[model samples]
Target: MKKIAFATCVHLGLSCIEEIYRIGGSLDLLITLKDEKAKDKSGRIYLDEIANEHDIPLLKIDNINDQEVLSSLKEYQIDWLFIIGWSQIAKKDVLEAPTLGCIGMHPTLLPIGRGRAAIPWAIIKGLKETGVTMFKLDEGVDTGDIIGQGVIKLDQNTTATELYKKVDDMHIALIAKYWHDIVSNNVILTKQSSADATEWPGRKPEDGEILSSMTMDETDKLVRAVTHPYPGAYYKEKERTIRIWSAKTDENDGEIKLSDGYLIPIDYEIEGNYGR
Candidate 1:
């Protein structure tokens, strides 16, 4: 059996963990964000539940650079590391710790969309097609060599929730297809083209702030791209911030139609301190 280390905190991470177990890979170590209570867009509990259920040793680390983290990883003698949906960008020592090196799953085709929130970035930027990438971990942010990839088409109505799930599904599929090569350390490597590379910074919850100056189409894309799991897009109204969970372009010449469909705050049951 092949021994692998897994790290993640998002729904995609959960899926990868589950698939790793299903495929009969030995997950010797499972690393994740410090918060196990964090929920995905679908409100699923963090990876702790899976870790406990699978009897995998779980490490909730805030910083992968800590000396203790590297020591713990060496103890496992792990064949490879999967850093999908993890919180921190791992440093050099962490990447080189594992015998076969660290691998990450980025939502966009690699050498492009190399920063945080690649899925949302693709949608907000009006990309027609985007894919998930599994690549070797390097010193830079998601600048790893390609191991495998899977593509998906994006339509105007493709919500962030939907795209996230799709990419994860493809991610798991590719892992299954390459399970043998991964465990045996026998696989072809493809170098990413730096000439075609473009990088974007990761987004914060406040980056979801929406403004009226944004085009109806732009606002629609922004709202849908950030909806669920991530902080919803919002604008200040009368000193209260109204975070939009959903929206669309209406038949009235692409006018922005708030999913709320009401002049007053409906609360939308989103996670916030505000009341209707």
Candidate 2:
């Protein structure tokens, strides 16, 4: 049996971890971020309970590339390291420590969408479809050889939370579908084409700000893109801000009017407190 280690600190990682165990797969170690280090991580959750329930050793660290982490990986003689829902990139030494190599799961199709804030970028770009990709990890960001991929169809109404659940489900299904092949060394690898590739830059909380000059459609897209499981898109007024959790352009009447049309805020939060 090949030894494996899993690292994650977010809901997606937790879902994948449970999927691994649910299918009778095994792990030598479970890795996660220190609680203090996880404050800013969206949908972050502790894995202590799951680890304890499965009797798997849990390792928490501030950085995945720290020397201590490298030592533990070597000590376990890990065959494969699955890094899911982790923000930090693994260094060369850490990537090479595992015999079969490190694996990463990205929310978008490899080569095409190969950078941060994939979920938001997918909606922001008005892509009708995106995908979940399982790939071998290398030095570059998500520029590794592909193991397998699952496509997700999107619509204008797709919100971040809805898309998040779809991606999470796809992750579980993909891992389960390939676990046997992976264990038997039957999983095929495909190189991503550089010509077809595009990258998305990372997003910050301030990036969610809604500008008054934006069209209603633009505001609606931004709101849906960042709503729930990410950050809420906001509109700032003098001395105050309003966080828009959900918005729709189909409504005839709305609180905020724009050049193209008006947007009805389905859910929102005022400066100091949330409002229904």
TM-score of each: 0.79, 0.90
Alpha carbon lDDT of each predicted model: 0.76, 0.88
What would the TM-score be for candidate 1 when compared with the true structure? Answer: 0.79
lDDT string for model 1 (229-257, tens) is 67878866554666778755443432223
TM-score, candidate 2, is: 0.90
For candidate 2, write residues 22-139 as lDDT tens digits: 9999789999998888687678899899999999988999999998888898899888999998888899998998889999999998888898899998998899999899999999
By lDDT, who's the top model here?
Answer: 2
Show pairs that collide, candidate 1: 41-229
